[model samples]
Target: MAEQVKLFGVWGSPFVRRVEIALKMKGVEYEFIEEDLTNKSPLLLKYNPVHKKIPVLLHNGKPICESVVIIEYIDETWKGTPILPADPYDRAMARFWAKFIDEKCLPALWKACWSKDEEQEKAMEEACELLKTLEAQLKGNKFFGGDNIGLVDIVANFIGFWVEVLLEATGSTDLLTDEKFPMLCKWKHAYVNCPVIKENLPPKEKLLAFFRARQQPTSGPKYE
Candidate 1:
């Protein structure tokens, strides 16, 4: 029997995009179910009962929650282009950096984009410092995944694309100026311009409109 695969996600969510990219990279065929986060679908709730979050991959009736875990599942289950490295140590390092991007970089970056005044300043500094740490990781690599996109690159979708969008929508910060982090800026330009990645990304206008509607009063990111 052919594999049954379904991906449940929210539009414009970088986390969801991560899984989508992985699936496409592996040449896996799957159905995409767009979830309404405000009023989530019962299937989404059922599939991900714990966090009730998105980017859940349903494979052969089994649900995989969390983007990173789902991605690892995709890598192991499919036998096409590799997402994680082949060497055990390299794979472990990739997982480490993916964890850092999620647990450290994302929260600070999201907070920096949304928070204001002193709070924004603090968040921005923390985010920049974290980004600088990530920057150092890219000394010789064109991507965190070396020459091609991989786990860390996928995990960092938010920083590479959404940071600029958030900054534009808020019109409140210049946190990621090219001069401040030239290497990252260059990486961002290159990563998003790749044909495969560029085609899969949510339309910038739609994203900007969505985020513009979502601008908050300094309470900060919904989860971060």
Candidate 2:
């Protein structure tokens, strides 16, 4: 008998989308359960009691939490298109960038979007520097994983899709313009236009609406 695979996540979440795209890349059949982040489901709580977060992958009744961890688990469990490179050094590099994006790049971008006054300016600077670092990593490759979309590519989904919307909404495209971050911009274009990613992406208008609604004048930035 085959293992039962299930994913609990929100519809427009980049983290969840990464796992979804990986599943599609590997041709893994799984059940998807969308969770209301504000009113998280009992199953989400049950599976990820510590975080009570979505993007939890359940395989054969065992749960894996955290988007990056879940992606690695999916790659290891399914023997289809490989996510991580086989060489140990390359694999380690992939993990490093994935963590860097989640910890450094994402928070920096969030700050650029939500922080006010001097904080926002500082965040924009930090985000630009971080983006430059990421751009250098591409080394003119079609994707972060060289010729193919791999772990780092999935992890950096936000840059490919969400960043443009956020930048446009905030009137901050100057921070990541085609001329400023040419390689990064080119990579993003490639990443999003790839058939697998382009086809499964959430409707742009819906995603724009989701972020626009979140831009409340009073609320602090919340990294979901």
Q: Give all TM-scores, in the order shown.
A: 0.95, 0.94
Lowest summed lDDT window (length 10), candidate 2: 215-224
Residues 1-224, model 2: lDDT tens digits:
98799999878888889999999999988999988877888898999999887789999999999899998988998898999999999999999999999889987887687666788789888999999999999997999899999999999998888887876666653577888899998988888999999987888888777777764434423324
- Superposition error at 141 for model 2 (Å): 1.3
At residue 209, candidate 1 shows an lDDT of 96
Residue 38 displacement in candidate 2 (angstroms): 1.3
Per candidate, the number of residue pairs that clash is: 0, 0
By summed lDDT, the worst window of 10 consecutive residues in model 1 runs over: 215-224
| lDDT of each residue in 1-224, candidate 1, tens digit only | 99999999877889999999999999999999988877889999899999998889999999999999999999999999899999999999999999999889988887888887998889889999999999989886788888998899888889888888989998767877789988888888889988778878999999999889974845433421
Residue 108 of model 1, lDDT score: 86
**Which regions of candidate 2 fall more than 4 Å away from where they truly are?**
217-223
lDDT for each candidate structure? 0.87, 0.86
